[model samples]
Target: MATLILVRHGRSTANTSGVLAGRTPGVLLDERGAAQAAELPARLAGLPIAAAVSSPLERCRETLRPLLDARPGLALHTDERISECDYGDWSGRKLAELTEDPLMEVVQQHPSAAAFPGGESMPAMQRRAVEAVREWNARVEAEHGPDAVFVMCSHGDIIKSVVADALGMHLDLFQRISVEPCSLTAIRYTRLRPFLMRLGETGDFGSLAPRPAKESGADDGRAVVGGGAGAP
Candidate 1:
């Protein structure tokens, strides 16, 4: 089995301002976001991370900068599949204003059936995000062996969607999952099935170290899904 760590990017200027941001260019991480990013290397200090994959968006990239700096030898890659959702007409809108829109109701209660006015559907977003993780999981296992661990830096909604798929929960119910900025979620992929080790863990990880190598057949475990509010 291989371990996959999904990290939501640190807070952005848009996030602090309560803006949707959605694929908009020039949106960088706010000062608080920078502080959050700076804390990652320490949170992940002892893990044997083989690679660091990130969304192509600037915020995601900026969020990953410190980690890369701490581990210069670790390889880094960018994948568009993990980028922020294309919010279409809703892009850059305040969440408070969108609350009055009828679509907002569907997004909160039944995301699987919801589609942005002129943007991508929730189902489509989940499909691509899940597929991207699966591909990376296989690649990491092949190149770094079954015990390899890696990180994926992405957005709030996308992380929630991926978490939903990992737990085999309906996309509509993904609203129950919450992923805060710079939070950490982990999943272990095995031939039998995926095992979710943690979700939305926002504490200091300085004490959390990598597990020792295990013998075969020790991969099976109970599936646990952590819960919270809907995506940002």
Candidate 2:
């Protein structure tokens, strides 16, 4: 097992404006987002991150820039699987305006059964995002060893979906998980099961330090542990 840190890209123009950017091109981080990105290097400075991966979107790429700068030797890779959900016809629409659409209710309450009119079903999104993380987890471990740590910068919904899978929760319940922009969520993978070390952490690196050993009764006797983080 290998550690995967999931990072949600910093706030973007679409975020502040209340529009669903979806796969829209040219959407970049806003001023506050840049500041958020700037602080990430220090937040993650002490971690032994071996590689950096991000969505192809500009927002994700911009969010990863500082990390790359801080770790000049880290290789940056892009994977489309972790990209934002395709909102299809709803892409670029205002969330407030979309509230009137009947599908919004399904999206809010029964996401597992909801599908964007011209886009993907929520369940399908979860499957792909979960598979991508599993695949990368294995690859990183093989390349950098079982203790390797890596960063994955992605979108809000995608990170939430991944978190839901890690927690063994169903897709419909994924809505209950909230990921903030530029936040960090850590997960540790072991041979027996995934351990959620942290969730939706922001503006602090205090918890990023190596976790304390499990107390006597808390030990599960699992080996090959890895760390994970999710940022939205």
Whole-model lDDT for model 2 versus the true structure? 0.79
Clash pairs detected, candidate 1: none
- Tens digits of per-residue lDDT for model 1 on 1-232? 7899999888788876667888889999888789889999999989999989999999889988999999989878999999888788888887657767888778877788888888888789889999999999999999999999999999888998998888889987887776777889999998988988999787854323444322110123211111111122
TM-score of 2: 0.87
Candidate 1 — which residues are off by over 4 angstroms? 204-232
Candidate models: Cα lDDT each: 0.80, 0.79
Mind giving the per-residue lDDT tens digits that candidate 2 earns over 181-208?
Answer: 7988887788888888778779655434
As for model 1, its CA RMSD to the true structure in angstroms is 9.8
Worst 10 residues of 1 by lDDT: 222-231
Best by lDDT: 1
For candidate 1, the TM-score is 0.87
Cα distance off (Å), candidate 2, residue 202 = 0.4
